[model samples]
Target: MVQTTPLVDRFGRVATDLRVSLTDRCNLRCSYCMPAEGLAWLPDERVLSDDEVVRLIGIGVSRLGIREVRFTGGEPLVRRGLSGIVARTRALDPGLELSLTTNGLGLVRLAGPLAEAGLDRVNVSLDSIRPETFHRITRRDRLHDVLEGLQAAADAGLGPIKVNAVLLRDVNDDQAAELLAWAVERGYELRFIEQMPLDAQHGWTRESMVTAEETLERLEKEFVLAPAAEPRGSAPAELFTVDGGPATVGVIASVTRPFCGDCDRVRLTADGQVRNCLFAREESDLRAALRSGVPDAEIARRWVSAMAGKRAGHGIDDPTFLQPDRPMSAIGG
Candidate 1:
């Protein structure tokens, strides 16, 4: 059932990357992501098991031409048997590029296991370098723990670890320089992502967002950065580096500079929905197909069809653009 045709959307953008959410549970409650309380966790039966996740990924690789897989969640590290899932998925396609995005709160205990399980790299969510600011943003006092987890990840040979920092105007925005210095000193790549309207509380506003241009302007003050000389490829970030420094930083301008034209990524939520875009208004249910004992080819067909129906773009900038009902955490970011 391996189709010769690639998974190309109507716009002709081919899909090569898949993001799978392991769970919707998180330890820390980031203000920009989730509310302080009142999150209803999905039932156990609704969540996909590790075997199911690995099977879907195998189908994606063997039939849909997917080459890279990233595990995301409320925090991927929160899921039990995560290392085993990584190992199984990697075993499916030895050459597949496998990665994970986590809050790093649990990475201190899981990094080594994950690396041994064949994880390639990681992107950890770290908003601020100051403990007070970190607590204020994440509502957790685990800044020291996160730093330790990052070190553990590095020690486990997770090279080129990226730190994802979401910038909110006047909220931890002034610490961009300090955060960069901290990451550079530790040999970690830092990336600033503009705040999107993905919070569960729907508190996001255009005025509250700190644009990528603004971030670069602030970063340029503390470091001599030049844009990367090579093509950006399909990566969401616009990369830059210090004049002669070892560390590099990236800015993801999802709001300002949409990468929808070249978006190669599709997301599978923990409950089994296939989302063409992060801000998609609709999702195709893959779990139903999986649970119905459908053939792997049929499951792949659902994926292919979903990609075909992908809109020209997410339409985030459109006048009628509506925020998704699913928050960033539930959506696997």
Candidate 2:
């Protein structure tokens, strides 16, 4: 049954999407994402099992009025038997719009299988078009593999394929136009994201930050851009199409242009914690309850209770704003 009363928060924003972290482990060490070393991985036992994850997602869909489910990870493809998880989640609600955000390293091999299983679409992290730049940003030489994976995903019919590029000043910022052209040429929607303060190293400063306005100024110099019709609800990206062309670009200006007012995304960590906002300081431990064999209805009620305390905004701009203890990888972004 569709939930009559959705997960509405203090601000009256009803969450229709849930981003679930499949694992807190990843293969790449992006400079902006995590440190080069000295990182500890989550114990295997701490992560949610496929059955547990599916059950939680089902409750969100059937009782909490969640219409879309997005699987994220340090890199979701790293988890074994991922297609099984995807198939199980899809089975819960035939109408659930399921998607994933991946670094694209393993999609070359798993794209077709995952598509066949029931994945609706994919968002690939492609920071740069230049191989050396890609390597420099991600600290990996898997650019070739990622490129091949994009083609494989397209061939497998996993679209509309989106390329998520986190723009950093003097780093990959100069290549913004080139990256968009490359993605447009390949039929991918390229979205340039402003670097936020979610880095595990906590080294994010406004000086190194690349704002959304700067990104648009850079892109508009290369292509004609007019605001495309936005869909109803809280979508992070503001989309634009190239003049006289079908290809488009989007900007996620979370810092400069906050979207928290319309924000409707809630998150579940791989360890079974529920987060109302990505930058929330507080989290509720649902894993403990699940492991204790608590009833599913009670678990669902706990989810609603957790989100009921959703904050007004992430407060990234506040003078006293502090980065959350969990990094984006651990938080399921």
Candidate 3:
């Protein structure tokens, strides 16, 4: 029997996509993701087991109107039973987009099984192609491994592989055009994201970040980019391409051009708390209720109420911005 779910704070927008964070722990101490002191990694017992995650996703798909599920992590590939999890998610026949986002450090080994197990697409977080600058940004030296992993994903037939580049002033910002052109040559959809309020340890300066407008102006100087047919809601990206190419380039202006309105995403941490916003100070715990054996109907009810009660948009753009208590990794970014 097919289960039914009630949609929540999704507003008029259907809640179709679910981003599931497998763990808050990641190997790369990238300046943007965590504190210099590091996250207080969740105890193994506290984390939702693989089985637990699958069950919640089943409920989400069957009831919450979710048709897409993306497995994310501090680095999703780091999880041992990852392929098994992907298999279960695929088994649901959710008729959804099943995708994965990663640092690509470990993608070489994991991409094949994940692809075979029904991962539809993969997005790699690559800030710079330069080995030295890459090391400077991520504090890791696995650029060659990452490149090979991207290629491995393609070879595995995980088509439409994407690269996500975060534009940091004096960092990878200068390479925005270069990266987009490179992605175009290879038929990859490249996305440039403006860095937002991440952990204080990352040393984010509003000054060091580039806005979507700045990126567009710079790119339009050479390439003729017309707007996309339909703008995806609250997504920070200003998507375009090199005139007649199949590949597209996207710019997410979350920091400088906040897309609070029309935002339709709710985040579930690896520990199973639902966050209404990346900048939110509050979250609702569904894991506890599930463990209490509450029926799926009740869970769906809570999901809707929570969704409706959620502020229309995350107030991240408030002049007096308070950083989310949790870091980006914990939030599944």
Residues 270-299, candidate 3: write the lDDT tens digits.
998877677877888888888889887887
By TM-score, how accurate is candidate 2?
Answer: 0.97
Q: Using lDDT, give the best candidate's number.
A: 2
Alpha-carbon local distance difference test for all models: 0.89, 0.89, 0.79
Clash number for candidate 1: 0
TM-scores of the models, in the order given: 0.98, 0.97, 0.93
- 1-333: candidate 2 lDDT, tens digit per residue: 344457889778899999999998889999998998736889989999988898888888888889999999989999888999999988888899999999999998999999988999999998997989988988889999999999999999999999999987888889889888888888899998888888899999987799899999999888999788657358899888788567778999888888999988999999999999999999999999998999877888898889999989989889999999988889888
Sort by lDDT, best first: what order?
A: 2, 1, 3
- Using lDDT as the yardstick, the better of models 2 and 3 is 2
Question: Given candidate 1, what's the lDDT at residue 43?
Answer: 94
| Native-referenced Cα lDDT, model 1 | 0.89
Residue pairs that clash (backbone atoms under 3 angstroms), model 1: none
